[model samples]
Target chain A: MHADYLWTAAPLIVSAPMAKVAMPKLAAAVSKAGGLGFIAAGYHSDHLEDLLQEAEDLLQEGTAETPIKVEEGTPKFLPVGVGFITWSASLEKALPSFSRYCPAAVWLFAPPQGFRDLIPWATRIREATACRTKIWVQVGSVSDAVEVVEAIDPDVIVVQGLDAGGHSLARGASIISLVPEIKDKLQELRPFPQKQIDVFAAGGISDSRGVAAAVALGAHGCVLGTRFLASPESLVAHGYQKALLDASDGGTSTVRTKIYDKVRDIHGWPEGYDGRGLINRTFIDHLNGLSEVKNREMYREELKRGDEGYGVNGRLTTYAGTGVGLIREVIPAGDIVKSLREGARALLYGPHNVSKL
Target chain B: MHADYLWTAAPLIVSAPMAKVAMPKLAAAVSKAGGLGFIAAGYHSDHLEDLLQEAEDLLQEGTAETPIKVEEGTPKFLPVGVGFITWSASLEKALPSFSRYCPAAVWLFAPPQGFRDLIPWATRIREATACRTKIWVQVGSVSDAVEVVEAIDPDVIVVQGLDAGGHSLARGASIISLVPEIKDKLQELRPFPQKQIDVFAAGGISDSRGVAAAVALGAHGCVLGTRFLASPESLVAHGYQKALLDASDGGTSTVRTKIYDKVRDIHGWPEGYDGRGLINRTFIDHLNGLSEVKNREMYREELKRGDEGYGVNGRLTTYAGTGVGLIREVIPAGDIVKSLREGARALLYGPHNVSKL
Candidate 1:
């Protein structure tokens, strides 16, 4: 019974969208591999509609072998989800996708501060769509978690700790402490007015023990980023993959800043909210002359390189979480998922007990 | 050539020394299995001689196989090495086995600020025995590394990075940067070198990619502490092994302090040099109040409860490196070594060819 429900196969992994890395084909391959695939709705051109169509088309083609069967009485199908940078979703044209494609879930990042107003809009979407639309708000601190639980009442609360890659909502707490605290707090305050929210832990959840730890810490599952960043299906350049593999505990250090966002012309990120990323040669030079190169033009040269696809050379930071330290290889995302599941199971069940079971 | 040099059907691995947890028979079994077996040096006692004799006796009675030979031309001997806390090595009385056993290498840690004089004496003993004595210094920064290289000029330089388990030299620098810098510095200053120094990088080197990455960055090999700390042969409590297996990325937090040293009453660690270890409940409650109860008498009370002995009390502070984040299993060290070697070779020989070898 467990075998049927529990995924345990060669391709049990999913590839998540990263900035500029997650493209249509990557999502399609993950879905094709029998795992939930997601399209990152954060950084992209104005042709988001075309991009969504492309991803939907790929997901359809990828899942052609085993079409998702919606039982006659069931609501809708489940195969793919769309994750939006919560801060980015509020932009002028971000709502176009809501009017167009019926995505599985709208995974939100760094839940906005003004949650009192966004509640009705979120409810409206859930009520209107047959799709299991969830408000996947990313958070770091226990307080932020508490705020989201009370205000947004998200369908799924992604406890993205400091270990997670990309932008984070963690005020300062690390995932290690934040996970168990949130889990315990949720458990203690359960069966009350608060909805039964399924918690997922992200940030540096690269493998199975990580998955198991999250489960132990009160998370249903895990969300991996850097681990998937190196997948063959990921649109990340070969150089980026090599850099990820090459990094170790001290190989890369991340600093949260709005320096790149301003240069890349990406706006609307909330104050006190910044992304963590690698510091390359350009960053070093800029840091050396921070006072001298205070002007936007000086930073423009660095920013242009990233926009043009220079890969690691330009100031385009390899926005990664602290978990970047854990990534050593870029294997197929499917293999990673298999390892995570098996490893988690093995960790939960003693090796002796596991074999006996 | 590599295949022949490597053993296919042996179960040799390192033994953990969890006070009373490690038995002589386990050490014998590891040596009998065809791997390097280490007996942890006394942290609070001077019974190492008795332990060594017991291990030798056990090997003789445990098997019918021929006594293990480390390398050809060496006297019929056991492949046993002694591991010491660098801070403790300063107490000459604690290192009585130095003259009696003639250990292959004396792994040094947090050497006194000006302990360069001690290296010659330590080196002379190994030179007299012609045991190919290595001075494995634990370091975190490039400056610390340079000091170690300039001072000891030992046979092998073991660079214990942030990822390794146990007490590491606390320099804010990461292993990734340190390893490359050490390699480059070594290359840059070649003629002064007595021999081409071999640098082995440690910490978070849990798998092949880690080993391959270290070797690529100019490390001859790698060292693993946490991965070995949980093996069946280790003296660690079963619960500790479970904790290690259940850990994930950022699963355990590492802090450098004299809290454990003060509590264990194990002296000799110089000021400014602290050990990195697990931060548990005891640390959280009493870490700030250490000054009030920093007495040997109170430590005795904690030791009487014997929390450190059983590794149950969070205050006992388990010396594990940040690599605890990656260790998900307690398999034999030999199996780990084999996997690392094979996996590294696979990647090195794999089509991508990111590795320098």
Candidate 2:
């Protein structure tokens, strides 16, 4: 596994920073499976201290119960990171927690107008935690990458594609071209020591082939959200799992709408960055004039009526990436990690034989 | 082209039954560019005589106008076919055109329960026309293919994937496996000439690599519809063309809802089959409870408000398959055909060395 990680290997599989869904158990399982895990700091500033203590406690519990067994004397506690939507954490209130935890990696999603304001602050934490808690930023477009890389100069950058099950920040280009373009941009940046920056590509990375393709495209790792959503450890509803299995081919059927964000009363996201979800009944009726429902009390009541628990009605907006089509069943996060690794190995080193679909 | 069609080629190009869009000019453009083109027969039993007469007239016109000189006896007019959505054109309604046209090929979309009814009817047409026209059925699922192939015994079978834009009659197994499975099933059908049974794959086939992959997987040819929807000759409105161009990297931010269908009053579609259209302000509002809107009288007023000129809104349903994502810009039908054919040839016969993407 270590050899595969260094050279001639698939990416280091990392779970996505899915809000509410990225629980401690899911994170622990990812770390246990030799993959990176993230605890999303979504609207968590109010409870940051307790959240960090809980996450740290879980990591310690996992390490104590099942020590990393790669070799007899080698260290056990694998790396675990924490992520936050950039603008959300930029709030004056969230700054204390952001400074306190100094996570293995502080991942930023949906960055603000400038990374400069955030980078210097994050650098203080990096210096405090000699453990090299690197700073990573998520970007959707080539220009986004160039902008962030030039400003913040994060240790790692995550390139998210449209295929990802969740909200994609991609406004221009695609994951196909974005990866190479980012690599070229990094080469052009040409910082001291020819900075060894890592680019992690996220979204629609389900099986080994997807992971292999990402690595082949110059991504050091793959960040998977819906892939983990199908894991047994996930907090996702049972009906959602059934929907994932029933889905055929690449699970690419998704609609990015701001309805849920508006309905749930969750704000702070900029325009053009909507969420991708299944078209349920509530969504159907109000899709045309959301402003009508948003403004009118009566229409809002009608939407409330359809909010039955997951699968009972179409109103429950199950957030999934395009990769949901490829997931046929729910399994342990660790099992998925093993399968992804093994699948890539077989594709790379296995005999040149065609397998029947 | 004929030699490759018989031996080395795969069926990746799909001729759009554009109804009015499939004029002789459009058909000739695709055919002369070395791709298959089909004439559409939609609610045209009354016009079949004129339609066939016009088609022949156009073929002669194309032959006389073709710039490149051929060998002494090469057929000037390339192979052209006619297609009908089977369920839409009931047997009694469409048979007159089949007899009148005696096309080189006859294509049917949507399988009926009594598929056996098609075999003898098709055979009668073949017998009368000296077996020149081949019977081809468009199906969605492997099971649908099995049922139809077992009952009708068509000469060619088209496996339409979920990626196909517009109304799909088939369900179950995706186009990826569906193509190979149909080929295998046809081979197993006793008393049939297996080599003569060509299986073509359709849906989400917009580029050269897709065509090459389909051929490599044993498909006789590919079917393209969404790709052609953007062609200059298509009757679709300018707004529709702009929308198609906006759908880049095959990334379609669309929701498959019945809002437009209900507003337009086009009924009799199966429950599972929904249409994919651009996710705009209008679609999001009406997707959920259009059933209520359907029950109410005076709903036509709201529908009228949504309509723009030339099928932009409620008037047209923006019929497309998943291939809409691959389309970047609107070009001529001739250019699309020529590029696809030449692109496939290059990939098939390109240089020995290749780099991983």
| Residue A351 accuracy (lDDT) in model 2 | 52
True contacts kept of 1: 0.03
Candidate DockQ values, in order, are 0.05, 0.06
Give model 2's DockQ, 2 decimals.
0.06
Error of 2 at A95 (Å): 6.6
Candidate 2 lDDT over A1-357, as tens digits, reads 233222112457888878778876787688767677787766545665566656667666544423432211111222566777766664455545445554556677775555565665466655555435677888776566767777767778898765555666523223444565566667767655355677887765666656654554456777888889888888777777766665543322455566666666667785557776655544565665556345334435544544234442445667766555556678999888878876654543345411221
Model 1, A206-267: lDDT tens digits are 65545544544445556777778878878776666766665544323544555555555667
Residue runs of model 1 more than 4 Å from their true location after superposition: A1-17, A43-49, A62-78, A91-100, A114-121, A169-177, A191-196, A207-218, A237-239, A245-268, A292-299, A302-314, A322-357, B1-357
Model 1, range B1-357, lDDT digits (tens) per residue? 112213212211233332344445554555555444456663543676677667656655543443453342332233455555544443455444444554434455556565474575456655544554445555665556567767776555666554444555433333444565556556666756656666766655555545554544446656666666666766766656755665443323555556666666566666545666666544555655645355445555555544343333434557665555556677865456556555655544445432110
Best by lDDT: 2
Model 1 vs. true fold: TM: 0.53
What is the DockQ of the complex in model 1?
0.05
